[model samples]
Target: MTSAPARTERSRTDGPAEPHRRRRMALALAAGGLVLGVGAIVTLAVWNDSEFATGTFGAGSFDLQGSTDGAAFTSDAAAPGKTLTFTLDADTLAPDDVVYAPFAVQLSDTSTNEAAVTIENVIGGTIGDDLTYSLFIEDDFGATCSAATPPAGAEVVADRAADATGTVDVFDLTAAGEPVSLCFVVTAGAIGQGEAGTITWEFAGTSGDTLP
Candidate 1:
């Protein structure tokens, strides 16, 4: 009876300790999750603060200057029906009397493109019938028509066959004052003339995208 009396009920506190431990573990997990969420929110705010700022993008001229016998043309305006008239100024134009009339066509540096030059629609005067003329172009390129050497190029622009057109290679102008020369060596014909002869004609310069 004495041995059995010592067996008292020991209340096991260890059983309840497990639930407290689980509660502590759950609280630690929740604390860790909260910390991660706060860190993620901070990272998101920092990333969202970055921003990016707002962003922003003509023709050339083709002009020409023309002259006759070293004198500038009356008007540089070029169009249909426009003409340059060269009149015989000598008191008497005898046979073999050669007159060298130096003419020039200038292209300004402001012109962005090369021009195609042409002479057309030559209407001769009554005196022109009795006279014959030869046209020559200087090979030496410059602005001045006054060249020291005689023009050697034998190109006939006017003769018994009066109506003839002449053309130059599409070329760029030297400068504003500089020009290519077109020399007319007009000679009196063997046939005698009645009145003062005249040569009335026009020249045209056109520029476009066409290439040589």
Candidate 2:
């Protein structure tokens, strides 16, 4: 009896099909990993580049000008009545800046009665010798005044008061001109330097007159 035809050996091609399936699976896993890595990089870049905060900065600047009319303690033997004019200027300055201004004058008396001679006597020539007169800008805030030299014939005194005033002795007066200046000094609470401000002084009296 013819035994059942031996079954044909299963085709050996099935072995090759198993390896192909494994390769496809591995390719799919690698693609998925690559996609995940790209997504993570994109997220980090966006977080770092974003503008999370904001801020602002600003700045500003100032100047001072001053003038006086007469010097030399008003000439001796001058008219009884004379007036002196003074002017001050505050240049453009920052709001934070502060300024202080002070001034002084020199005078003298040739007459023996120093008590009888008044500012007028010095100005009028009633007292011929040189004398000094001074005015101070009250220090509303504690501050200092700047020092300056007088004209060629004038002399500047070295006396300074804590109250923002300066003084010159009668002997310091010159026949030439008065020493004048605008002082810019820093005080507590001042913001910065170069702030502009001005100070002025005016004198009016008879040349030979005296003040009470």
Candidate 3:
């Protein structure tokens, strides 16, 4: 009779605790699933990442021209390994005769640099002290050289230097299609006639980008 009375009421209170524990377990499982979903989305976004870009680079060119009496020859372009040569009009000379050799220097179409004119070589036969020359630069705007005004002196050669290498800073050819003017004065010094000589102008172009 005692054992039958105890077994009757023990089963009823355990029902509510079982359902509460089941609800807490369901909420934890749902939160863990949401966290996993968020992690998957973040992993996908990181896997699909990217970057950007830009351009390229190149080099420049240098070229020049030498002219006498309106005829021009480009350096390294007119002929292979050939320098431009011009003849001076010192064919006839007398004592105290100052001859003006008007000439022009031009930078080629592809030239993008400043240039210098050097007296590279000067040779003569038997002029003695009669054939002396002076180099000058002109500020004339005309394409052809003008003799109306006196030229600005840059270098003077009293006698032919066997190694004549001197530079004259003429007008710079920083822009394209622009040219410079030069002049040489061969003065027959105090000596006898029947003399002849030759002068060579070496125009060397230097890039503006490499200038000091």
Candidate 4:
């Protein structure tokens, strides 16, 4: 009797099993890796755009006055006839930088009378040699009146010896009704990284026939 027909060998392709689950797992892993890489790049970009630090610098001002007309006469010094006050503010400034402030005075008057004025720098004290300043004068018509050197025994004060910071007071008399204007030039020394702040100036003076 003939043996039962030989059974056909099962072929790998003929089976119901497939690589679908493995392929799906691989695709999911690749997509996850791409998302992680993009997230890391975005995080780095944001971190680089932020500022580590910041600061600001500025100056304080005072009102100018005159004795005679109050409206006609003006002195570079504060409230002409009163003690002038100057305050320096060095806030948030880099420790290495220097600051400087320059000042100029103008006098004007409508009357024919001539006026005389003087400016002084009073910081630490007179005897201690702690004060310093330069003087410049101009007439009502903006004409140069005279130039003078630093007063005897006067010291030029500065935040740093190499770079100085201070004020200039201008004193002068006007004719009678003319107008006068004063200008101040301010400067800061080589700023170091991270230094920031403001400088304040306080001036008080009296407007009279003569300077005190």
lDDT of 2 by residue, 91-122 (tens): 43343333334433333333211121112112
Candidate number of the best lDDT: 1
* Top-scoring candidate (TM-score): 3
Which lDDT tens digits does candidate 3 get at residues 123-186? 4455633455565666652222224554554443334433345564444566555666666665
Worst 10 residues of 2 by lDDT: 112-121
Model 4 lDDT tens row, 86-176 = 2234333333322222233333332333344433332231211221223222232212211122122222222222123343343444434
Please provide TM-scores, in order, for all candidate models, with all chains considered together: 0.49, 0.26, 0.52, 0.25
Query: Model 3: runs farther than 4 Å from truth?
Result: 1-55, 70-89, 116-119, 124-130, 141-163, 190-195, 210-212
Judged by whole-model lDDT over C-alpha atoms, candidate 3 comes out at 0.55
Ranked by TM-score, the better of candidates 1 and 3 is 3
Off by over 4 Å in 4: 1-169, 210-212
lDDT (10s digit) by residue, model 1, range 1-212: 34555666647965688789999999999999999999886743343456787653046556677665444533456443333333444436776665556666776646666666665434355556655555666654322222345566546364432334455332445344467667665666664655564654455667754222
TM-score of 3: 0.52
Off by over 4 Å in 2: 1-5, 44-212
Each prediction's number of clashing residue pairs: 2, 20, 0, 40
Whole-model alpha-carbon lDDT for candidate 1: 0.56
Clash count in backbone of candidate 4: 40
Q: Regarding TM-score, does 3 or 4 come out ahead? A: 3
